[model samples]
Target: MTNAMQLNLTTPGSNLTSYIATANSIPMLTAEEEHALAVDLQENGNLDAARRLILPHLRFVIHVARGYAGYGLQQADLIQEGNIGLMKAVKRFDPSVGVRLVSFAVHWIRAEMHEFILRNWRIVKVATTKAQRKLFFNLRKSKTRLGWFSHEQVQTVANELGVKPETVLEMESRLSGRDVGFDGYQDDDDDSFAYAPAAYLQDVSEEPARVLEAADWSAHNEERLTQAISTLDERSQDILASRWLSEEKTTLHELADKYGISAERIRQLEKAAMQKLRSALMD
Candidate 1:
């Protein structure tokens, strides 16, 4: 509701242990107190009531955030995101539903943390689809021992998660992979820097010698092709041009109609013209 209130509850700048202690020190609300706060907020749009509802629940957010510790994100940031979810739950909470705030808020809290993990976990996203997202979070827990999953283990995980074995394998691969810098790390020494992708990968397209050679070769072929086409009869030349050289190529049927011949005859003429051009270019 207010910066002061959030800082008092989270104290995000402080060390993680201190933040956890502060969150745990906050008193829990009784059902009656929680209900009253929910009613006040829902009826009157009371920010203070919403803040009270959120304070006692910061501990629960910390607990949920701790479960995601293996993801390599900062515990403090995860807790902060979970706190935001708790606040959203507090605002939209319906006491009339006969559910406690924590039970209702768990989904919202985990949702925010999951989003943070997916976004920051990899430079490339590991999960884009709904099934992939489900597998991304659950795959690590499904593995009993590490390294890689055996075919049987993969199938087991797939069945347990209601996904295909291929999906399980793909998500497992993604989870196990680490992001590497394309140009190599800044701290890399001379020998290591030479092995980096930027050092070894060449962009030959931008090389002046290669560029000039390709252009010259293309021009030489074009000159030979023009000379070869000149040796063809007028009809053969026109058909060849319309069929192969024009921007808007003429269809055999169109050529047939124009020349008062059957489409088969047009095809035969085209074939003969191509053979003559090939022979001339060879010479």
Candidate 2:
């Protein structure tokens, strides 16, 4: 905490070349040194030992993150996510596992980067299922041509990926689609608005009947909550209000001092109060 790490993996101002240069400058750890640091952290909780172990392997995270550059996401963001995965792997690493930390950490690093890609690659997500996710990453690399896949090529991809040809075509269609605004262009004069999704797409939420139904449902729930709160005793009511309803919740210790009881007693009372509220709402 005294000072920040000097080995800059990705700073805001640094470009890809600068990041690569900084990463390349860091030295990789030998097997003996890595084992000693891992043992130091595992046995004695030495953070400095952990840092030394982490610093050398940051270049590896950068290397892995580079493989994801075609996704159109920021290079810095990918590396940052990969860095998180590396830290997680380091924390769980066992020195006795008879493998180097980098070997174990690669999976963790890519897993984090994959999550980041799935989250940000498209506005509506190109892949939802497990198989689709695998295909999404591999499909680009599996391509043999620059344009659309031919019928035979489609079948080949389906065979290799263990997915249906239809599924592959559907995913490819989705990948090729671009995100359009729900509302028309920012400066709309009639022509632009006519082409916008909002102009033609059926908005179920905006229907008069749907709006009234939603309002009625919300009001009924509010009434039920009020009735539920009324069922509790005054002390229980105060605890629930201070702990749940108030902007700044009162902690168990704070409530215990106020009620002249132990924190454990407050917790038990709070639990009982919640059960009572649940029962009241059900009725």
Candidate 3:
């Protein structure tokens, strides 16, 4: 009997309306029949019994999927996910549990639908943590009016959902926000395009004008430094170069040895040169 019923069962496909009608047309099983099929699948792993168990519950999956229509996802996709949950529930159904398949399967069905919504609802995921997910589904339903939640409402939702008011507010903000293109839309006018993130959030380092200005400023400072260094006497120039400019910089004692002078005298000369350079550059 189960094999004949399985042969008659048709899975949902691209034609959603037709699939839904077929699902609704399938007969609901009596408690005895449901139990027998569940026992067959659980004990003997009968695929035929599993098919019979799942086929009749397709309408229930459709019913459950309808509640998630506001998530801006395709109805067909949600129904398909719910159908998978129905199959999983059938595979795990225990005949001795003394509960109908629908009751047992509701959790599995909603779980799949919830997962699907979380994945496809937005480009960026809104709810990641367990608490956020709980708040995500329940917060909207908790609202009495349309606009942003008042302090009292936030507190009420937080208390009821066992989360902080701040968390509730954060999720509300996420839900109310919309995804925007960084470059903006193709049909956007000048006014709208000017407001896009790409317009203002720019890399000044990459700008031609800024890059040219930075280069010119650096060149000017280098020119000034060269002139400043030129004002020092030849010996002072050599001392400064040896002490500061050289890659393998000389120590004060090393410069003193080359100059045939005490290290303290070399230090004083180097300091005087640096002071003259500073004064020239400032002028």
Which number leads on TM-score?
A: 1
Q: What value does the lDDT take at residue 51 in candidate 1? A: 80
Candidate closer to the true structure by lDDT (higher is better), 2 or 3: 3
Residues 7-73, model 1: lDDT tens digits: 6665465577876777788789999999999999999999889988988899899889889987767
Candidate 3 per-residue lDDT, tens place, 144-248, comes to: 454578888788888988889888888888888876654433431324443558667767787999999999999999999999998889999999999889999
The C-alpha local distance difference test score for the whole of candidate 1 amounts to 0.82
- The collision pairs in model 1 are none
Candidate 1 ranges beyond 4 A from true positions: 1-6, 123-283
**Clashing residue pairs found in predicted model 3:** none
RMSD to the true structure for each prediction, in A, is 15.2, 17.9, 16.9
RMSD of 3: 16.9
- Candidate number with the higher TM-score (1 or 3): 1
lDDT (CA) for every model shown? 0.82, 0.80, 0.81
Per-model tally of clashing residue pairs: 0, 0, 0
**Model 1 misses residue 224 by how many Å?**
57
Q: Cα deviation of 47 in candidate 2 (Å)?
A: 1.2
- Stretches of candidate 2 off by over 4 Å are 1-13, 124-283
Model 3 spans with C-alpha error above 4 angstroms: 1-11, 124-283
